[model samples]
Target chain A: MLKNYFKIAIAVLKRRKFFTFISLFGISFTLTILMVLTAFIDKVAGDNYPDKKRDRLLYVNRIEQKGKDNMNSGTLSYYFLSHYTAMMKTPVKVAISSGFSGTNTYVNNKKIAVSYKYTNAEYWDVMDYDFTEGKPFNKQQVDNADRVVIISEDMKKQYFGDAGPVVGKYFEADNVSYRVIGVVKNVPVTSYMFFSDIYMPYTTSKADYKSKSYGGGYMGVLMAANKDDVPKMQAEYENLMKRVPVESKDFQHLYSHANTFFSSYVDTGNEGTSGVFIVVTAISIFVFIFMLLPTLNLVNINITRIMERSSEIGVRKAFGASSKTLVYQFIVENLILTLLGGIIGTILSVIVLAVINNADLIANLQLSINFTVLFIALLVCLVFGFLSGVYPAWRMSKLNVVTALKAQ
Target chain B: MIRLQNIEKVYRTDTIETLALNSVSLDVAKGEFLSIMGPSGCGKSTLLNIMGLLDVPSKGSIKIADKATENLNDKQLAQFRNKTLGFIFQSYHLINDLQVLDNVELPLLYRDTTAKERKMLATEALEKVGLANRVKHFPTQLSGGQRQRVAIARAIVGRPDIILADEPTGNLDSAMGNEIMDILINLNRNEGTTIVMVTHDENMAHKTHRLVRLFDGSQVQ
Candidate 1:
């Protein structure tokens, strides 16, 4: 019986190709745009690669010092983090690393611009960067201020022009020569916390980076045993800052909090307007608005289709079809249309995602719709089919048999 | 048997009211062949629709086979319509989307028949209608006369207690119209199936056992 209804639905849709095309275009286009947009957001704020332990980690990247007439705001000083955050009970390991700085130098008479980061040995354990060759320098090397650097796969290719045993070879950057101790995969550019062209020890630099008067230029990446301990670790770090005596008598108050990636983005310091909530609400509204017009258009098209088939409906009703059967039949027809649209949308999204990834449009913006995105698309399609299918089916079912049969 | 008592149907709009049927009492005995003749706007089709439960009379009591139907719920009405009544229309009203066999199988869908049983029953009905060779042909592929024959086949395929046809020959010429009349006569006489048809032609009206004439929403003869 349902098969017969489907046959009739297909024939009817074929009879009115223009309307079907319009509906399919609306449904597929809306779904594709939504999936692409979701992919982008996931790439930006979501965890990937070495940051896969994001849920189990917290970052202390900023500090604020307030006095009667002065206020200072910057990244927490290495001294502050080492002295206070190192003693944290909740964190299994507290790794400190410098933010990115430009290394503009000449190698083999070729000018290369590389982003460099300074790190201690614990930085390797806290983050999981995959090594292609050799290993990260040990704590002893960092303490001895040894001249060693870890370079990315692309860097090795650029310098040696081949995937090579260039590890033990020396390369000069910023007028300083260092042995290439390790080679790692070229990290995607969007991974701001870990991506870098070269990594060295903070002590290897000529300037003293650790013993600073004011807080800035360093981040304390704390690895907790479990994700649920993040809030407690943050509170304990905040409490530890209270006991640290001010080196300068002029400063009276200190403020800082360890934060996850999401909290850090939404941390307005006011605590009332959260960035995560706002972004989620905005995206929700965006998706709703995107789907609204298409859903309405599909509903109208379904109404028109049902209207054309009213005589058939009347005939069926006259032959003992109940309203339930009619409604089920129409809904099935609509579901078929919506699922077809979903398939088309998925195909289009794959092509679009592949193009974006291959074109290198956004540096390190490798995007794909995983299972979560597919599930979202399917849910959206189901909701879309229901929203667009029900009212028309209901109205068609409620129609009087006499009036329906009289319709052309 | 089918019975209607003092049936009154009124068409109401915001500003006016038109009486389509007024104080009309009707009875159709078992195995009876009845013809109702009326001019345009005389409520023949409206009365037929009411009798088939497709439309409700404003003030009337309907009883079919000793079951009072006016108070029956929608589901009950549908069940009764499916199990006890069948309909044939002026345009044949065969669903064009379905093939001849599928269209004939439509009534069975409302019953508890399985797919295999439905196919078997539908096949037998098509054979009875003399369209055994065209089981898979869509309605458009058939002639006007054949479409009406298919409509008759669908009506009787369910073994309905009664068949109500509204202008069964309204769209056909005399020859095709006579062929339809003959089918109805044969079904009534041989199978003992009650048939009530509405026609404008005097020749067709005379073929039935009893005749009714309506004018201005009332029975004149």
Candidate 2:
């Protein structure tokens, strides 16, 4: 029976070319933009590359030091991290890395700016970076301030012109000399916490790490043995935050929490709610509002289109079709139309993403419609179909049989 | 078999209440071929619609095939219609987007019949209407008489006990009209299917088992 309705729906679409084109244009155009947006968000926040164990990881990126008259909030300081994170018992590993900083280098007499970060030996174990040549600096090397660096494949190509075996060669940056110890794949800039052109040991920097300040230019990555230990780890960290005493006379209170990477990214200072729930609700509302106008337009168009088949509806009703059956048929027809539009939208998204990637609009960012994006697009299509179809179908089903027949 | 008692249908608005069907009582015997005749605006089609359960009477009780219909919900009424009644209309009312075979198989779609069985029954119906070769053709591709035949095929494909037709041949010429009347008469005599038809033609009425006349929203004869 559904097969028969599908046949009729295809025939109807073929019969009305103009309406089909208009509906397809609206649906495909709207869904194309949404698909591209989903792809980008998935690439940025999804479990990709070295952050695949995101479910079992937590981040402590912000520290708050408040006084009677002044309040300061910034990334965690190395001293604050080593003091507090060492007291937490839930985490199997805690890796601390300095915030990325920009430095200039001269390659082929042309000045190029490079972003770099200083990390400890355990940072390599925390993040599973795929190294292409050589190995990371050991704990002994970091303790000795070995002046060894690991550059991304992209930076290696830029400084060496695709030269072979430069792992032991000396590289100059910020007017300082360092021996390159390893080369790894380029991490997309979308991974805000992990993306850098080069990485070095924190001991090699001249900054003071023994300061008692509660805030500085550093972040900590916490890894739990399993996902179930994350909450316990968060609780332990929270309790430890209350125990840390303020050394400065100006500040009397200290505050921080161990949160997920996404939570830290969308940190709005709102307490008592996880950032995941807040961000998901915010995005859902945003998508709903964005789709409202197009859905209404499609509903209006569908009403007009289905109204033209009043006589056919009357015939079906007179032949023993219940109102439920008629509504189901109409909704099915609309779904077919929307799914076809989704196919076109998916193709358009692929082409658009390809253009963006090839155009080099954003460096190190390659957006593709992966499985998650495709599933989201499918869900969007179904929702669009239901939102645009239900009311019109209901209206048609309520039509008086006699009145509908007279419409012929 | 069908029965109606004090059937009343009123078309109301804020300004006026027009009586489309008055308090007219009717009874149709089993295996009876009944034709209803009246001038335009005489409530002939309204009476037929009420009997077909497509429209509710303003004040009346109806029993078709010995089952009381007033208390039946929408779903039960639809099931009763699907299992016990068939309908044909003046304009043929064929869906233009579907082929003749699909249109013929529509009533069976509401039932639990399989696709193969529906196709077989629809093919048999088309053969009965002498349009077996045109099953793949659309309604627009057929002539007016041919379209009426397709509508008849759709009506009888369900093999319902009663067939309600409102001016089934009203739009056809005399030759085509006689041909359609012959089909109805044959269905009545051979299959014993009770038929209640509303027609405007006297020549077609004379061939039925009985004729009913209406005037001014009431039965006059």
Best by lDDT: 2
What stretches of model 1 exceed 4 Å from their correct place? A40-48, A64-74, A87-92, A102-113, A205-215, A225-231, A242-254, A265-272, A363-366
Error of 1 at B88 (Å): 1.4
Task: Flag clash pairs in model 2.
Answer: none
- Residue A269 shift from truth in candidate 1, angstroms: 7.7
Residue ranges of candidate 2 with Cα displaced over 4 Å: A17-39, A48-58, A79-94, A206-215, A222-250, A268-278, A290-305, A334-361, A366-395, B1-5, B27-34, B60-68, B173-195, B202-211
Write down the TM-score of every candidate.
0.91, 0.85
* Count of steric clashes across candidates, in order: 0, 0
Tens digits of per-residue lDDT for model 1, B1-221: 98989999999999999999998999999999999998999999999999999999999898888888867877778888999999999988898888898899899999999889988988887777788898889999999999999998899889998999999999999999998898889889989999999999999999999999999899888
Query: lDDT tens string, model 1, A1-408?
Result: 777778877887777889988988888898889889988877777755766688888877777777788777777666777778767799998788887778786766788888888887888888888898999998999989999999988788777777458899986788789899999987776666677889998788765676756585778788889989888887888788787666576778777778887767445543336657888888999988998999989999999888888888898899998998888888888888888888988898899999999999965568988668877787888888987889999999999999998886
User: B-chain TM-score, every candidate?
Assistant: 0.98, 0.99
Candidate 2 structure quality by residue, lDDT tens digits, B48-119: 999989899999899998999999887888889888999989999999999999999999999999999999
